[model samples]
Structures are given as structure tokens and as C-alpha cells.
Target: MTDATDMAAVRVDAPGTSATARLLAEAARAVDAPDLVLAVSRGGVRTVHTGGSAAPGPVPRELLTYELGSASKPYAGLLLARLVAQGRVRYEDRAADLLAPGLPVHPAVRRITLRHLLTHTSGLPGLPADFYPQAVPRWSTGPYGGYPADRVVRAFLRARPRRRPGTRWRYSNFAVSVLGHTLAAATGTPWEVLLHQQVLAPLGLDATRVRPGPDGTDAVGRRRDGTPVPALDTGGFTAAGAVRATPLDLLTFLEAHVGGPEPRDPALNAALTEVTRPLLRRGLRHAHTHTLTWFQHPSPYGRVLFHAGATLGQQAFLGFRPDSGLAVAATATRRVHRGDTFVATAYGLLTETP
Candidate 1:
């Protein structure tokens, strides 16, 4: 198994095979994810990052530190599916059954099942209103700075249903975070341990770990104003969003989902496919469509399995065409404006083949 230090030296050698490489390289320069971008293919991998930054220098392909943000949901969904396959839990199991007793106060919430939570059909809002700060941080840094799990659970208990369970689609971090807690309770293991054993270790993804940087090791990037923003730990929300992985490790995981010929547990693979499948069409009121964990956007290329993440000033994007077996993963230090240049570049790569 390779350690983070060894992985940091890994780089892409297949630049010529990817027709999108030059364009992606240009996009990486445009956004400030350390001016770094990685494009991976079956034959090889290529990395491009702008120079002249901190002492650690440019972001290395092997320095395993990336905040996956909501990208962790797909992994969480896989773990739940594994429990289902083991007969330890069922998709139809209600939230009340999985959660600590008497926690949910809403009558309608009792009807929410594991599947509903995984698919974001639990009718729960994105984040509890009480947790919302009236003012944005002067500088966008670790938005969920002090919010902890206990506070999250307290706010959730007081939450009323936005729509009946399974009636309409609404994204809820509270729901997924609760799902992680529930899984931990059912299996009697830390959520991170479960992920490492079931997902990372199985695929030989040694660099992928739940903690921000294994033993305080991390990659550095600058904020928009040219201030160095060290990677911030997400605390207990690791299951909901705190996963740090290198582009190669991420590509390895995506390859498994896209049917790359790696020895993966059959049950886990099936669960991955099931989760990525479109569960329901959200009402028009919501701005976008969603799959179990993936955000769906119609492109001329085909349906794309994609998720974008933001933490403090850092932003990341992962997208792949499962049918075409092509994937692109990009991260930036400065928050790329939503629907900005980075996204456009990612889509351009997804649609164009080598």
C-alpha cells in the first residue's frame, strides 16, 4: 500500500491521449485551485498546476487532501446498501427505527425511510433555518465553522416537514448526516472506519481516507485575496462531507463506478449503480435535478454523474460519463463562482472524448 508521501509523487503521463487535456489545462489556469487540474484515463493520467505559490509549492497529484463536500453522500449510500445486502438494515426501514428513540418530533418524519434519506426525498430542507447565519462571513472560510453534530440533531428534531416523506425532492444535509449516524449505530463502528474498509481498501485506494489529512498532513492553496487558507477539518461532519483524496484515488473510485475492471465486491458495485440511478424527478420549483447522490444535468454528450463541493474558500468538481468511461476531477482554492469557468471547462471535457 502506498502512503500519502509516496502518492504525492504520482503524475499523469497520458496527456496526448486526452483531446480535452489542453482545454482543461487552460481552465485550471483560469481558476485558482492552486491552478491545478488532473485528467485521468485507463492508459495514463495528466496533471497541470500553476507555479509560484507557497513553500509546499503547487498542489501535487499525490498529496491526498481534498474536501469532497457532498461527494461523500455517494460513499454513504454505498455503505447503507452494503448493510441492506447483509440483512442488517432494509431500505424501507424508517428513520425512527434507525435513530435514537424519541429523537424526531415531527409525526410525518416517522414515515421517512433509509431510501428516502439516501435519495433526498425525505422532504427535509437543505439546512435547518436556525443554523443559518443572518450574515455571511466577511471572508468565506469554513462556512460551518462551529456547527457540530449535536447542534445538527437538535435542529433536526425541531424541523417540520417541508413536504410529506417521498412526496417531493429536497436536499438535506441533516438527513444524510443522520443516515451516517444511523449506520454507525447499526454497525457499531465509526463511519470513517466503515468507509475505509468497505470502499477505499477494497479498491486499493490507500490515499483516500475520511480525515482531512492523515495525521495533520495536507495540501495548501490560497484564498482569492492571495492569503494561504490551510485545509479546515469538518469535525463530525466527515461522514456528510469531510473526505480527503488525491485525483488518482478519486479517479480509481470513479473507475469502479464506471465499470473499470478492478476487483470490487459485487454487492458494493451493485449498490453504487443503484445509488447513481435517477430516483425521482424533482418538482420544477427546485433549480436542478438529482440522482441518489449525483446532481443530474442534461448534456449533448449524455447523462453525467456529477457533484461539486465547497468548504471555506476551496471548491472541487467531479463529473464522469458512465457510458463513455470518461471522468474529470478538478479542485480550486478560490471558490469558482457557481456556473463559472471551471464548470464550463469540466463539461467541455465530459462531452469531448480523447
Candidate 2:
């Protein structure tokens, strides 16, 4: 059931982009998305492929936007690494140390460190355990919405670790959100401002919006049946997700992970290298491995580090295979369902790239 929009997304004669366009089109069909955007990078060069109409305007191929969910974690991770490289922070720094003095922390919470948070070994919940009450009410709308920075800090103080910090790996939005706050506390800057100063601006990603908005957005998330889905509000769990970006910017972000040819501050360069290295292992049979912020999977093309993100109305996947200098970014304006294949399809394209 191809349409003009889908075919139009895959035009030929773009110097190595058409192949990616073909793959992007396949991904678009697999997910039955109203709009899809993809970008591929090889040896630091990038190409973007976009399909359908995500919203009601003229979204130039270059600026199609999608919520980047957890795919934003690596950016947070990179910021940590950069600061550490610049001697502004240390990986072993305790969360308590960076957070406000006398913030009153649980003993277990006090034990969590920057490294633990970065590696997801801090034994924190995906949200404050108590957040379930709010979640149950707005389970479909915006569970993470009403909470704010102060509430997040209060939740961190009240948190009780199920397992010892660094003892086991558990993915936690609560941990990373606190990490972002801690970084802000340590640097004397707000989280969003600090992020822009250290990461987004440095990468020239003007199209990316990690804060509340860039306003006047171009894409609207749609269901497979074409119902428009509400945009997700991260509330206080921003560092865990809460990012929206164009495919081109996502590709540039991935290229940095693969040592792209760009002049960067020494700290930023150091961070780009650090986030991709193995940092921890856990789970049954030690079957899981993680970099500072990304989930690392073994692939024929070396480590395939990737993370998938889903907002209420969009899903995005970002990954890179350093051995192959291949990075792929794919997005669709549809809610992430249990069996969605958007992530898997994007991962395959990265691994399959030569």
C-alpha cells in the first residue's frame, strides 16, 4: 500500500542517500506511520530521508521533528563525561555531594554515585515508587507531568534502593533526573541552560529542543489509524527522556560518538569517547552490558550501541556501529505499542550497513 508520500521520500540521485531512503521507506511501512524520518551517517557524512506529513504544515525535509524519549540519555551521559574531562566533576562523585547540602538523603540513596547513575546501576526506580498513584490516574495522558524539579528532589531523598547501588543494574528515570539536577547544582546552572551550554549548542543542534519547547512545532504524532496523539510532557523526568529533535541533528549526535570530523572542546571530545566504552555488566548470567549511558549489544560490526525512545505520540531510535562508521536515526509519529518494530528495524539498518 505505497503512496506518493512514501515514494516521494525515496527519490534517487542524492549521492549515497537513496539506499538509506529505501531502508527508511521499509521502516515506515513496517510501523504503518503517517510520517517517518531517517538519517544515516557514514564516515561523518550524513543524509536525511523523510516521508508523509506528520502535521499540517510545510515541514522541510531538514526539520521534521519527533520526541526522542530515552534516546536523550546519551546526551546527558555525554554532558557528565565532558564535565569530568574538564575536571569539573568526577565519575565517582556521590549524588549527595553534588546535590544541595543537607538535602537529607536515605542511606542507600547517599551511596549512589554519578557513575552508578550513568550506568543505571544506582538501583533506582524508573520513577519515584510513589509516582504510581499519579501514573494510575493519568496512565494514558501524562503521568510524569505534574511533578517538578523540587518534587523530583524530594522523591530522590525519599527513595529506598531495592538493591545496593552498583550491585545490580536497573534503568531509572529517577536516577538520571537527579543526575541532571546534581550536575546543575554542581555547576550553578539550570539543567536546560547547562545542557545547551555544554552539549546541544556545541553540537550545532539548533533544531533540537530538550526543554519545554521551541514553540510552533512542525510534526504531530499520529496513530496507525491516523488519530493525532498528544505530545508527551516529561515533567521532571527530563534527563531520562524529554527530547525532541530533527533526524539530521540526531545523526550529527551519533556521528560524534563515532569520532566524526568536527572541532570540539577537549572536554566534549573526551566525553564523546567515554560514553561508548563499556562501563558495567549485570542481569542473568551477566548477559547485559552498558556503556556510560547506552545499552551495548554485540554485533558482527563490533558494538552496536543503541537506545530507543517513545513519547506519547512518537518513537525514535539512535544507534551507531563504530567499527563500520555507521549510525542510523529513525523516527515515526505513532505511539509505541508492545510489538512495535520501529526500533528493531532501525537497529537492523545500522548493523546491516557496511
Candidate 3:
């Protein structure tokens, strides 16, 4: 694990004056989030906040690892961009060209490009309704319990399009999950290993790993009730939202986006542009516009790039202003309402000066 003490030593300003911290502190308290960590780089800031379990006093930072939810989409976008940068793939290539021959996708679906998947314009739903089984516990160690990869592919093959590709924006976990498998086929490597090799290893993110704990590695928080939920078996959707990491490690990632050193392949810089660029306007109501993976909002400080993630009991947000080299990440155990509270808390943290 990276030294938390060393990360704390790095000078980062809070989002706002004392007021920013106070606002965030209020928000944190309101949501019952007890443990919060924030890191700012250049002109941006990132944070992780966790609500305490009723049984325990307060959740320890080291013990809290929540599902990133759709936040994992950005990493998937990065992986695809990396392939494009390496000449292994192209953005315009059809999905059928990359996957095996047996996929039963609609003819229009086959024409869907990698860009559509990254942009959430592929017209796939959040998850196939049939995949949801009442037998599965509401809050498992792994969010997608028992839904293996083969099942996911089968779901995709049988899926009927709600809208033609690129005509509209609809968030879809199934689409990105398919993208992960497509990358696996194109690269001839498991998506998990490829992500570590291409993104985490190069960045020196030692604490970030797929599937929380395997061979005695220390994992994050247990069940909300403190029942010590076993490590989640991600089954096949690991690439979608199964990776785990500490707040400080995530801060390091945000730092790299705002002019930090290229920890992975230098070629990754080219890929960053494709992944971060704002491609479409999501109808979702927010102060900012949505990009391929990141969200953009016009702050007094400048344009801010941000994204949020949520599962059963975990909530996370990453916000940054590239022009000012400022970034902020915030994670919480309880899901907070999406609006001024979340945006204000994130922006206030980003505006803080060390």
C-alpha cells in the first residue's frame, strides 16, 4: 500500500475558504458520512467521504471501499483509447470486427463504433432487466452477484435497441460491459489484467486492484450493518465497476489527468484527449455537460471535469478543472442527492488553496 502519511503530507488546498469545508462538513454530517478525505492537485481537488455504519462508531478510511458504479466507465474508455493510441484498434471500427462471429447483435448494433460505447449513445439500458434476480441480496460484497460474462453476452445478443446508435444518450452498464469483452477479444488478454498492465501499473497505483481481496490482501468496508460481508465475487462485470482503491490512490489518478506525470505509457496522453473530450449533451439535469467519461461544469474558476459513482451503499465523485490544474474526489458510504450539495461540495473543495 502507498503511504497515506506521505499523501497527507502533500500540500492541497480545500475546495473553498473555511466556508467550503463547512458546507462539505455539513453535507457529510447530513448524510451520516463520518470519514472523509480530499486531495487537490494544481487547481483541482478530489475527495472520498464515507458514512458510518450504525453498529460501528465511524467507518475507517482504510476499511471503506465502495462500488464505483458507472465511475468505472472512464477507465474502460481509457483502455479503449489506449488501444487506439497503440494502433491495436481504431475509434471508428465496427463492434462486430472486434468481437467473435457468433454475437447476435442487430445489424445497426454491429455498426456501433467504439466511440458510441464510450459516449453512452449506443442505446443500451443500464442493465438487462432479466439479469436482475430477486434471489440476489440487495447489497452483496459484489454488486453484480452471479451475473457472469457469458450471461452478460447472452443478454446483449438478445437486446433490442431502444434508440439507434448515436441518436440519443442513455447510460448503459451492459454496453460498456460488452465493450470490455470486445477489448478482451481484440487484445487477447483478460480485461482485468489488461487494465492493471496498461493503466494501474504505469501509474504506480499499488493499492488499486480488481476484486477486493484474493490472497489475504486487506479489503475495504464490510456490510452497512457491519456483518463483514465477504469479498464480492464480481463474476464477469469486473471491468464495469469491480475495481477497488483507496481515496489517496484515486487522488493520484486525478492528479495525472491535471498535468501530472504520465505514469503509464507516454502514449496514454494521446488517449486522454479522446476519453476526456465532451462528446454529447446528456439530458440529465446538472450544472455541467457530460463528456465521454467526465462531466463538465462552468465554475467561476473555469471548466470543471467531474463524474459520480454509486452502488447500494457507496457514493463517489471526481471533479477537476484542467485549465487551473485543479481536481477534487469525494466518496461517501451513503448516497447523497444529486445536485447543489454534491456540486457545491466538490467545487468548494476544488477552489481551496493550500
lDDT (Cα atoms) of all candidates against the true structure: 0.65, 0.77, 0.64
The digit string of per-residue lDDT tens for model 2 on 17-72 reads 46666665665566656777767777765556666554435655446667888888
How displaced is residue 123 in candidate 3, in Å? 1.4
Q: Candidate 1: minimum summed lDDT over ten consecutive residues — where?
A: 43-52
TM-score of each: 0.84, 0.90, 0.81
Q: Which residue pairs in model 2 clash with each other?
A: none
Arranged by lDDT with the best first, the candidates are: 2, 1, 3
The local lDDT score (0 to 100) that residue 260 gets in candidate 2 is 72
lDDT of 3: 0.64
Best by lDDT: 2
Cα displacement (Å) at residue 252, model 1: 0.6
Better lDDT candidate (1, 2): 2
Error in Å for residue 334 of model 3? 2.8
For model 2, the superposed segments whose C-alpha errors exceed 4 Å read 1-18, 52-56, 212-216, 264-266
Give per-residue lDDT, candidate 3, residue 32.
38
Question: Which 10 consecutive residues of model 2 have the lowest summed lDDT?
Answer: 1-10
